[model samples]
Target: MMTRVVVIGAGPAGLVAAIRLAEGGARVALLNKGTGGLQLGQGTLDILGYGPDRVERPLDALAGFAEAHPGHPYGVLPADLVARSANYLRDLVGPALLVGDAASNLQLPTAVGAVRPTALASPSMTAGACVDGARFVIVGLRQLKDFYPELVVGNLVRTDLPGGGRLQARAAMLDLPAREGEIDSTGLTYARALDDPAYRKRFAQAVKAVVEPGETVGLPAVLGLDDHNAWSEVAEAIGAPVFEIPLPPPSVPGMRLNRALTARAKAAGVRVVPGSKVTGFRASGGAVDSVQLATAGGDRDFVADAFVLATGGFESGALTADSYHNVHESVFDLPLRRPEGHLVHGDYWGDPQPLFTIGVEVDEQMLVRHPGGDPVYTNLYAAGGILAGATRWQEKSGEGIAVASAVRAADSILAAAATATDQGAAS
Candidate 1:
């Protein structure tokens, strides 16, 4: 008998699981509400501790773990698989990896002047570069605009990068003015700028003019570069090495990855459904049998041998728990572990000490746990950012954790199915 697995959501976590499960000889179907939340990100996998100190290059650290744990769900595969995945990602976006030593000093150009200091690899390197009196030159486009330079300056001030002194930053707006009463979209806007090589070159020249000689310029992640090729030219022409800063609220990288993965998953024979919300689950004894999905056509039942929940946190609209101390799984009514307070602290900014607290409890095998600390579902598994007890943001281990957890979950599910098949054959 063929084993069918239903996966919800198309974020990094969900996509990774779907691919791995398919490779494991399981029939996988992925469902989501369009795109998901990945596009909003900057697309850089933040591996915080890869250096000798284990305090930076976090992705490197995770890579080491993957290397050690051969056949583990999150472990690194053969060189070919790694190369293929990296190439696929690079083709989809600008670059797969942003390499830089943590201890090396970076020269940052701000509004006032240039500042040189030891820079750490982060999605947003501008803030950290502001230390040692780095001058920041913020470039803003006229029409395709989203980031605010003033806000970044404020954050730099809060961090006290410049010897606890004030930051020197300047803003240059690249006016891509729009027509009156016209709606501007991300694709169209990007197309308008990227279609013309001369336009992009002129824009780069304008940006270069604003910066002093030998000063590194900080720009938004959206540089209007070619989807397939542009990073090298853009970096060289701009003179100063450009650092792409991540935008808050809605991340562009996260969104792009979601779309790319969704398309790839569908093309690979996986049924990709969106806007179909999972209302509840049908369970008997200790196992889930089916899921109730609500779509425009009305409610329908999707039965599968196994299930993978990747709805994500509150942002992705997966697990919804109210202030009354009551939590709803949203789809299967799966039991969740909730903290008393919504957030550990009042302020939502910065690392906030312990950071956010919203995840499910899973055992070593990646099986969701019950209130009594026992596996709730034999064939059910959970992974990615939704897994409890790990903070992806503060820990700077989002991509690593998601990939690792998904691998583990898929392996466990496959192992369980194999065991069940063997038992039935014996019986």
Candidate 2:
């Protein structure tokens, strides 16, 4: 008999866990309340970008980072597992699509032209790495209101790279051929238009005319949505190396990543249940039997042999706070580990707030633990932002922790299932 597992949330963690479970021969059901965070995030995988200071070597810094911050998710996650998870995600997303590794952090230019460090990035953004003597022409479409090439160039010219480099950047704006009744276009519209081979050729010509010698072209991340080759095609047409600068929320690169992972999950035989909010769950004898989902008619129960909760933190409503500053986990009402005194203090963006560090505690195996360090449910595990200690945004370890913990949780479930089969045979 196949082991049935239910994974909650559709973020990177949940999707990864579901895919691993299904690939391990388990019947997996992935549930999500709404869309995942990928659409609002950069497609790059950030693994420990900062350890108080900028981290050049992410894998090498893991042990020190874990020691500095006790009870952090990295404290339990082995470095080898973290490295393996990076490879696993790259393989799952396809080597040709996702590039980079955990060995070193790449300083990629953000939408504002400020440097952002990431361990893994798409091929479209790899050429944008801010290195010594790197010259760039930040290009923007006149019709695209989201991107500002002048602003990007202004920032890039003043900013210094993490690895001791200065940037020389210029700005250019070109008018793209407008469709019927179209004056301004969203990233999606521009992405779809670029998918056409003919449109890409014309677009490349326009970009090439504005480019100078020894300057790599930097365009807004609207190259393609459905087509991954759009960036390369444009680069080929322009006859120059080009890279993408990710735009604000509702990101095209992010959408491409989400679509790719979701598609891979489905292809791995995982059943995806979308738009279902998990309101409650049934647990007894320290094991979860089923979870309740809110429906149009009424609440429905989803039964499974095991469960993995990857529901995001405060951002996704998985964790909420009341007027008195009492925070609570939405689904299981699990206990949270919060800092003493005020939950938040100091500047909003300066120092990491204590409140942001509050989350459910999990064992090394990714199982949620009670206040006294006992598993709440033997068959339940937690991953991603929900099981937190370090402030992910502060450290830039969000994707790394999510992927590694999800892999650990799925591996634990598979091992448990195998042990059960062996016990049954022995009996």
Provide the overall lDDT of each model, using Cα atoms, as 2-decimal numbers.
0.57, 0.90
Stretches off by above 4 angstroms in model 1 are 47-54, 57-136, 150-171, 178-192, 195-198, 237-240, 340-358, 418-427
Stretches of candidate 2 exceeding 4 Å from the true structure? none
* Best-performing candidate as measured by TM-score: 2
- Writing each residue's lDDT as its tens digit, candidate 2 over 258-334 gives 99999999999998989979999999888999999998889989999999999989999999999899999999999
Candidate 2 to truth, TM: 0.98
Task: Report the lDDT of model 1 for residue 3.
Answer: 77
Give a tens-digit lDDT track for model 1, residues 1-427: 5578988877777887787677677888888776665664445443332222224323334455545433222332322333333333334333333324332333333322323332222333433355555566666655554566665555554454434566565556655433333444353355346436765676677777777764556665554423423433566777776655545435543444565666666666677777777777888877889887888888888889888887777667666756754656666566766554544466666443332345666776777777437978876788766665445454444554565566667777888778888999999
lDDT accuracy of residue 237 in candidate 1: 77
